[model samples]
Target: MTDPQIERKLIEIMRIINESDRPVGARIIADELRNRGYNLGERAVRYHLRILDERGFTEKHGYTGRSITLKGKDELEEALIGDRLDFVITRIEDLIYRTDYDPVKKQGNVIVNVSYVDKDDFEKTAGLMRGAVDYSISPRVGVFEEDSEDIFVPAGKVGIATVCSITFDGILLRHGIPVKPNFGGILSVENNEPVVFKDLISYRGTSIDPIKIFLMRQSTSVTGLLQSGSGTILANMRSIPQSAVGDASLLFQQLHESDIGGLLAMDNESGNVLGAPVDVGLSGIVVSAGVNALAVVEEYGIDVTTRPVSTIMDYGTMKTL
Candidate 1:
């Protein structure tokens, strides 16, 4: 076949077109590609569109641009499967005998890596395993995806961020949000009341004109949106209610105090991006929850404008474990 990378991009383009409500031009497709971590141009995207059209995977509507066909849909699903199987099978082999499985619980942790590190340094760090399990060694068996408790990051400049677990990732993926590791600015926006529903509807606050905010359990809202960079997108992200959960400021506080990495909310119905929020992280972002993108590099905080604002690390899936 063609180079795997090219083949992947061809499928990716097909996938993007498949997800859109209407036919989208190459520019919009290219923008979506970049948001999902592909650095490509509209010209390059159109080239692939042409190839897909030739393959009968995409169809053009005069000047309305292209959309994916049924054959393309089948191809995309197969692509997602083929892309992940190798890694999943390898990780499975690594922990074939070490994990606890429950078909009912569906909870399990895979031993992804065994590495040596400074023992003193690991404990000094917050939000780690801490006293949860027995330690006493320089080598760490690192493969617990996340901690059970919610991690709270203080509000500040660029150094701050809202981290979510794989549990949260699946929710957004089921929504319109693409399931991929990504980092980008909100391109534009149209503000409205936020909701807790994955359907991207079902209101929480009616009189709260402008912001129909709610406490987001499954998804997250990063301060760095509105400059979505892509075309107008109806964004449904994870967010917290304006009121803290009991004494807990929760994730919403991070978005509110954002001098950097914070919530850039989007209205899902209108499909219009709202105005971009100011740099709550003009100084930086705080790690408000979970692990993964835990620390803030110095240069990144200086000015998150060009990039490194909010970060997301895609966690692998769970199989019967």
Candidate 2:
């Protein structure tokens, strides 16, 4: 097998190409290596490029240049997460604290506070909580609609929304209940009835409140690329909801048919898409964030999560937020 260090260098090259948002030549890449203090030669760079092409990480653009493939983007994402992967793996070390009080009912409840990295970390941690907690759990992802005061899901129970921050060590720090709201309420899902503040608490302070708190960690990384502008991309295969699979598949098809030139498929339940096999007639892939569906655009190979806006009608009142 190739040396792991060489693999890392190749991944760095892929990242630079992807970030550039356009094709690049080896001379530029060689110069970049020189600036980084690496004593690599043009021939060495070409060798690595050939290996990447063979592995489907990159492809020749036309005659003289090359660009990143969908597989390249996926590999680069994994590579960038080096060391940071601990943030996700060490989630077990995180903790969620809970307490509750029912002043009006003359009974106390439980409130669970999860300490984690940030909003994304909070969401991933919530997924972990679903498995840890004995009670039934549901996970949802979306931004609060404009003009809406709160995030809501029809017929769903409200739970505590913890504010999370990231430590330099990649630990997720969470601050629980009494979360301040600007216009909308806390991050709890809204039901038909107003999702009152107390609703977000874990327990009503009755008896030793049965509420439980759990924590899961999310890992994020920010790495520089050569020509591509700076941006954020979420990588995971399990986070995709089962209910959204069809939409996700259709979005993949749309992307494959577009000018971006790439393919996408559900790699696993985590919402991560492995590099899809595509004809060599197309360009490379670029993966990024989206809405309800994981979108794979062709030519550019941009993977975006987006729900078909038209699919909104298929949803029932029970599904509306």
Candidate 3:
């Protein structure tokens, strides 16, 4: 059998060609491979294209020298899921002054506050955001956000964060805007395990135009980060709306603001943060809620929130709990 790695590469090449709106040439594919630090020659790329055609993954056009096929699209979608792509969406809020203000030199800054979720969930949310952006204003460029910290694993964790940027013709106009003809397909796992997905979209403004303008600014900021070697992940993701009752919007906010090791203080009445436990040694903490529980304030009584509290630990230096 052919090496799985080599087959994977061939599949990736086909996917790239299919995902591209315009038909791409073999030379262009070869150049892209070279830019990615691969020593793939144009002849080798052409050979792979022929192989793909034989396998029914791609087809050559009658008159045009370029080609694309449904098989190619399916292969590309599979690759996108396997790779676990990362993306970012920024909402811009432009503050216009009543009097004369320099629009060019001085501009209002729009901060896109990001909340953490599972990698799959993040991709799904990003896809929806991209669709909104595409349908609203048709943005020419976009920014990418990189994962700076290590992936949170149960045991023996390593420091490696995947990030990437994609430039497409789209812009997300409003906060509560709904996506038409949703592109977010079936979100499933290889082992058939259930996964949690959340969508967090926020905007604080009166005018929609200024918000759209601010989105452009925020996109620029994210773009800058991607260009500066901070964002490094693949493109192509699925978009889903925030409609489920179990979305953990508030908890995510608390996690983002609190210190890495701080305790998650819960409010009994509102189920929100009354305050966190400071200077308290925590062994470990597990935050959980209902599968579709939206209002976590009172549901904490019915749901589950568990954590390990450490007692009698020396704090001056590193000591065992």
Instruction: Compose the digit string of candidate 3's lDDT tens values, residues 165-236.
Output: 110001111222222211111111112221211211122212122122322222212222223422111111
Stretches of model 3 off by over 4 angstroms after superposition = 79-321
Q: After superposition, how far is residue 212 of candidate 2 from its true place, in Å?
A: 35
Q: Flag regions of model 1 displaced more than 4 Å.
A: 85-321
Using all chains and alpha carbons, the TM-scores for the candidates as numbered come to 0.33, 0.27, 0.29
Q: What is the total number of backbone clashes in candidate 2?
A: 52
Greater TM-score among 2 and 3 belongs to: 3
RMSD, candidate 2, Å: 23.4
Q: Supply every candidate's count of residue pairs whose N, Cα or C atoms clash at under 3 angstroms.
A: 48, 52, 21
The prediction achieving the highest lDDT against the true structure is 1
Cα lDDT tens digits, model 1, 184-237, are 121232242322222232112221101112111212222222223122212323
Candidate number achieving the greatest TM-score relative to the actual structure: 1
| lDDT accuracy of residue 316 in candidate 3 | 18
The C-alpha RMSD in Å for every predicted model, in order, reads: 19.0, 23.4, 22.2
